[model samples]
Target: MKLLKSKWNFACLLVSVIWLASVNAVALDARKVEVRGLFKNAAILQVNGQQRMLKVGQTSPEGIKLIAADSKQAEIEIDGKRTVLSLSKKIAATFSEAALGEARIPAGRNGHYFTTGMINNQSVKLLVDTGASSIALNSIVAKQLGIDYLTSPRYVGVATASGTTRGYRVTLREVTVGGITLNNVIAVVTEGEFPRDILLGNTFLSELDMKVESGVLILQAKY
Candidate 1:
């Protein structure tokens, strides 16, 4: 009975040591993960300085799994902990925190700064327009985004290059540009598709600090 008891204690000690080593290994791997690029249903990751491209539902050799991805961000699972990563900025903490976010938009071929952003959880192309008083979109685009502007009680007139047209003022639930997000943003929906792209106007831009560097537009949330 004494010999059997000794064997049991040794086995328990060995198991505890192995479990501790496994936990340490996971922590080390988590520290090495860096998001390099983001795409629809895919992400480029750098683990321990080695780059790896992982599509949705794929896992890297280092045990990092890409859960979901889009131009804005990537969702990854490492060591059973899920985290969202972004290409625009490196955040030390999870996005659930009210930590400020920054985004860099490089100039396009037309010498205009454009980016893919989220409006009400849906992806949309955005054009930075400082002259616009409020976030503006065409009635067609608004309908595709499920915005019921026709029923909105706030009716207004919007001036277009052609002439003055009907418009509806509404509040957006959320608008996210890169890592910066704002809630309850006022916007205008014009009756016709004059502005080719969604105008990211002053209503959203006013809340952020904007600067131009090397033809790149950097938008950082003030709060």
Candidate 2:
């Protein structure tokens, strides 16, 4: 009788352990699913769905790759699944150009002319000038942009290399680059002869998140 009772007790214990393990496994799976959903949402926000066609395919090392069929959409591969994703047009257009290297800003060197990007739907080219105390513009550029330099307060000073220059304290109504824009930017208009057309100075550099890594100057607006 005792032997039979002991055997029954052992069987019940094993069953209980198995049931508890199954419950724990289900809980872990639920957590993983929730995390994946959150990540997808975040990616979607950064890049709109309309611009890209998302597809899945089997690949080496990893089981599958999620690719953007259209160049207008940024291509990303999802490993281990076959799926079709429809994204918003805005996201697709933004990524497609990026993937094609159309909108990429090439790495700039010191004393080189580089595009400052778009501002108020206008493309502005900036010359890298470390010596200028503030962002300086030539009379021609100021006039071309319809900036009334004569109306603003005048500041007379000598430039670092150019002798005896006259400047003005003018606020740029809008300055933009790389899809980023800044309002009321402080700038100086120097009358001195500049080797470059426009000078990108500390005034603009200070307002950006700048880093020089591996001989590349990466600048991003702080806003």
Candidate 3:
């Protein structure tokens, strides 16, 4: 009976030591990272070249949890199946307009200029409208740009194809077409029933030195 009791005690100690070592290993393996607002609910966390999905309310087997604070980036797990969620103050800054798209005037109709690129990470078609006083995005275009039109602040008395209509005025953090990037762009968000997608109005054009000749609009970035 004494020998059996000794064996049992040794086994329990071994198991406890092993469990603690496993926990420590997991802690040491976790990597800190920053998450952008692009990810919601379920996001694949990439750390040290490895990727893992972070589900809300669930801690990684290693014991990490992911919580979203805002559009800015946040810290996340890097390695191992489970880890602890650690917030890092060091996060990647949002992209500037120049960093978002390339610049080049593409072919278009009616002597108007066209540029193709991503707006809010989605493909968009923009028409250069010098006549327009500000950038105008149709209802559909605003949705595509991920602007929460309904909750957006109201700006009354905007003219549209349907005549003067209620609209929302918002500043796009960045607008990039071709190699040009425009920041703090004023965009008019029309009501649900709008006709066009997006019209690049003078709000953007006026910022540049442009000349229209032979059906082509030349734009020069002004200092």
Clashes of each: 0, 16, 12
At residue 170, give the lDDT of candidate 3: 83
TM-score for each model: 0.60, 0.48, 0.50
Full candidate order by lDDT, most accurate first: 1, 3, 2
- The better-scoring model by lDDT among 1 and 3 is 1
Query: lDDT of model 3 at residue 191?
Result: 79
List model 2 lDDT by residue over 28-105, tens digit each.
444110000011111111221121111222121222233433332223443333344344554333222222111223
* Per-candidate local distance difference test: 0.79, 0.49, 0.56
Pitting candidate 1 against candidate 2, the one with the higher lDDT is 1
Error of 2 at 31 (Å): 53
Off by over 4 Å in 1: 1-100
The 10-residue segment of model 1 with minimum total lDDT is: 91-100
